[model samples]
Target: MPEDAPERVEGHTTRRVLVTGAASGLGAALTAAFRARGDEVLATDVVSTPLDHRDGPVEHREHDVLRLDVTSDDDWAAALATVEERWGGLDILVNNAGVAGGGRIDVAGLDEWEWITGINLFGVVRGCRTFVPMLKRQRSGQIVNVASLAGLVHPAGMASYNAVKAGVVALTETLGHELAPYDVGASVVCPSYFRTNLMDSLRGADEALGGVVTALVETSPFTADEIAAAVLAGLDAGEEVILPDPAARAAWELKQTDRAAYVDQMRRQAARLDQLA
Candidate 1:
């Protein structure tokens, strides 16, 4: 995208959307989704890796991909400052930056817990803390935080991932209450097995367990783009909790209707994983 591209589309009310973790996977897909709708997006991540922008809707827009480490307070301040100065104000904030440390609590040390939580939970806290004031001043905005179905239904060997994502779920649910009076809507997306590289970055995780996760996800019917589609639609409709995959929706319902059964089922799944290991 050109730096001097038009701020607004000729006849459309272009929205100013800032998406974190936009270097790949769901974040990149969501950025493209918004860009396809002609919105100005600030796509950010921790690195400047070359992106897959071919045939993307961002071909003729002002959506620049930037390097932003979400765990850094200074990075949050600088990123928002750039948005405030260049785009004038923020309309949509997607805190999609997160990490998954794929191991049980016993295998994952306190260090792993702290690492994933820094980006998964506290990063979201900082994003909302930094931008809510701006949104309140503007009197309208939306926030989308990416959690996981693991938050709804815990599985084995994912204690840290489950822990941080559950916190994100709680945080975003509370954010909805706090932002309503200011007319700022909040959403927490609980995505199930999608074809993202989430398992690839796992720290101190079993290689066999990672393979199992990848196989399950790759065999699923959903993709990153499909999840992004659900997220964009839910955001447009002001839906609170966005469950993008059928497995996620099922798990959410099971948690609501039969907590004991859900736990038993997960226990069996854990037993199977034990056998595999």
Candidate 2:
């Protein structure tokens, strides 16, 4: 970005932000980043872990997406009511909650796939279902759904996660178009790697599958702060899609040019990864 670009982009400031999955990692980083910029941030996550950061204007809370299940209309209604009571009107919402499902689509149990998609995909859907109305009432707001580079270009061994994130990307894209009438912007963030407890947070249908995913995460290399910065940039620029890393953008470009070729290339890469393993 140009020296003045950030300043120009951030010319306007947001009053309030609600970030899901804020117990740690990118969610935690985002809470601090937004608060540092003078926004009142309400960060929530399923875990009841203590939020130890003290660098900004942040209010932390425990939020279980399962409790706020998007699949449940009543739950969505209640959660929205609670959010309305706390902030009056929410200016921005970052749907950053997700889980990793193993790549073995064919062999992965149906229950495991369902569990992951419910959290990773339907989680975002529920957020939109619950919050979009309020945002519309406010007439100006932003919804940032945290997808993955997998959403843009799937690699082998992440079938469920890839599918859900791809759904998030598609949903947010359509949402952006739908929200334009209300002057509300929707953005889908596709990030690669990102150092986070994502490995530890895996909620598989069983223990053995969880172990497989945990091993893979040990090799991923993306920083939470970097991804947070990318998210902030997307919000500031009013971008419809945010690719948090250069490699993610490159991968996306490759997929766009030749999707079949991209899949074959990823298969080769996976073979190399297996060799390393």
Best by lDDT: 1
lDDT tens digits by residue: candidate 2, 95-119 = 9877666645555788878888888
Against the true structure, whose TM-score is highest?
Answer: 1
Local error of candidate 1 at residue 238 (angstroms): 1.7
TM-score of each: 0.90, 0.82
lDDT of 1 by residue, 1-277 (tens): 5565544446767898999988777888888788777788898888666253232333323337677888888989998889978888999999998876767556567877788888888999999998999999998999999999987778888888888888899999898998899999999999998877666566765655666787887788888888999998888687898998788898889989999998898899888777787
lDDT of 2 at 55: 23
Candidate 1: misplaced stretches above 4 Å? 1-12, 53-63
- In angstroms, the error of model 1 at 139 is 1.2
lDDT of 1 at 188: 94
User: Where is model 2 more than 4 Å wrong at Cα?
Assistant: 1-14, 52-75, 203-221, 258-261, 270-277
What RMSD, rounded to one decimal, does every model reach? Answer: 3.1, 5.9
Compared with the true structure, all predictions reach lDDT values of 0.82, 0.74
How many residue pairs collide in each prediction?
A: 0, 4
